[model samples]
Target: MGWSLFRRSRIAPGLPVPGRCGPRRHALATERLLLFTPRTRLDVAAAIAASADAQAQGWLGTKADEVLPDPAVRRALLAWRPAGEDGRRIPRELAEPFTPGPDDPLLLVCVRRSDLGYAGALELQHLAGEMGGWLAPGCRGQGLGAELFRAGLELAHTHLGLATVRAGAETGNTASRRALARAGLVPDQGPRRHTLPDGRVVDAVWHRHDTATPAHCGDHQESPRRRPVTRSGSGHRTS
Candidate 1:
């Protein structure tokens, strides 16, 4: 699917329609979504708590009660990677990249551009394979997701040197799937079940996007359908 870029001549126009599709619309100029390094542990916790509360209302997915109090969840949120020896904390350097770390691009927190509030995060553990992301419920509708994701893809390509990245979303998650497709990722298959922190199995769909793929960012035509909600870790996406 593809969309038309809608731009208004500022010199001669009143105001551009907000919904007008644009190609690779940049959300913020600085391109920093708040620091996700280990130093921002408290911020990461707040983000995780907010995401969990948002998930409870079904904006993203269901969160397990077990993870609610665990500090490891915050670590995962901060680094956008799995929790380390501390369980509730992820090393700051690991969130980005360090000399003596795993080759996998660490998970990074996604913050709101305006107030630096924790909006969501992205996780991409495997190269050229599956990656995922999530947002707080309040942050779901404004189109920031697409912008952040585009930036994320660029980061993956630049830092990790990966030519391709993969992702997944539930069939009912219209916003997320649309964000992925708008980011040039393609939907692949049907509902796949995965084990959650609380040992519950939930269904989700798989998607993929390759840097080598000849895709455009303006094509956002996917729609979300209603399905039983599932969880992806405090509603955060892991690579």
Candidate 2:
């Protein structure tokens, strides 16, 4: 799971349309975490730090210095935004007030369960196509990663209309691979070398999932598809 937490910025192909599912904005809730919007910048930063710091262990291969906010780094990661809107491409809006179409599905995370002091999140960008997540080292275990994956998968299939889900890990990242295995994704074929900021080539293990496969094993005993996950009832939710 630790190695799986490593996330680098390599782009890949889009996923297929999901099979029949529900509309977007389905909210997921637990006693310790709440999945909705209006998250504070501090919370986002904390989660980001957890994610980047964990990846720095050389498993994800990113430098630990990359965790904090910098105008330059922001510019690079913020490219996910469209070109015209604000032109900055940074995440200006956490969640929109309007209903989501088939293309966009956003997710939020928070500490909710009474016993689990965990705070982390996962966002299925273009839930119909791409899926990415962030984890705080505090919330990395106790089965939270599997929960996050299930939440994202539900969004991908039910709302975004995506049939397949994709994710990647550093070549030797066993922790993340386990998380992916928990979710139901299998290694499609990777060990693909990607150039990093230092001009060094880093190998990665890319994985993929289809309707037949699951993203998490769920409750450890039930079928992967039978796992419990929170979903949005409305079209979407924002902070």
Predicted model with the maximum TM-score: 1
lDDT of 2 by residue, 1-239 (tens): 22122222211111111121123333444323444331334334434444454243344334446555354443333322211222332344532233334333354544434432225556655422445555555455566555566666665554444566666665565666677678677777534665444345556666666784333211121122232322211111000
Rate residue 32 of model 2 by lDDT: 39
- Root-mean-square deviation of candidate 2: 14.0
lDDT of 1 by residue, 1-239 (tens): 01123333421132212223232111211133432322244444544554564343343444455234554664345443223323445456434422213343344555554444456666545333345666665566777667656656654453344555566665566777788777776766534765554455666776655666333223222111112323323222521
How does model 1 fare in lDDT?
0.46
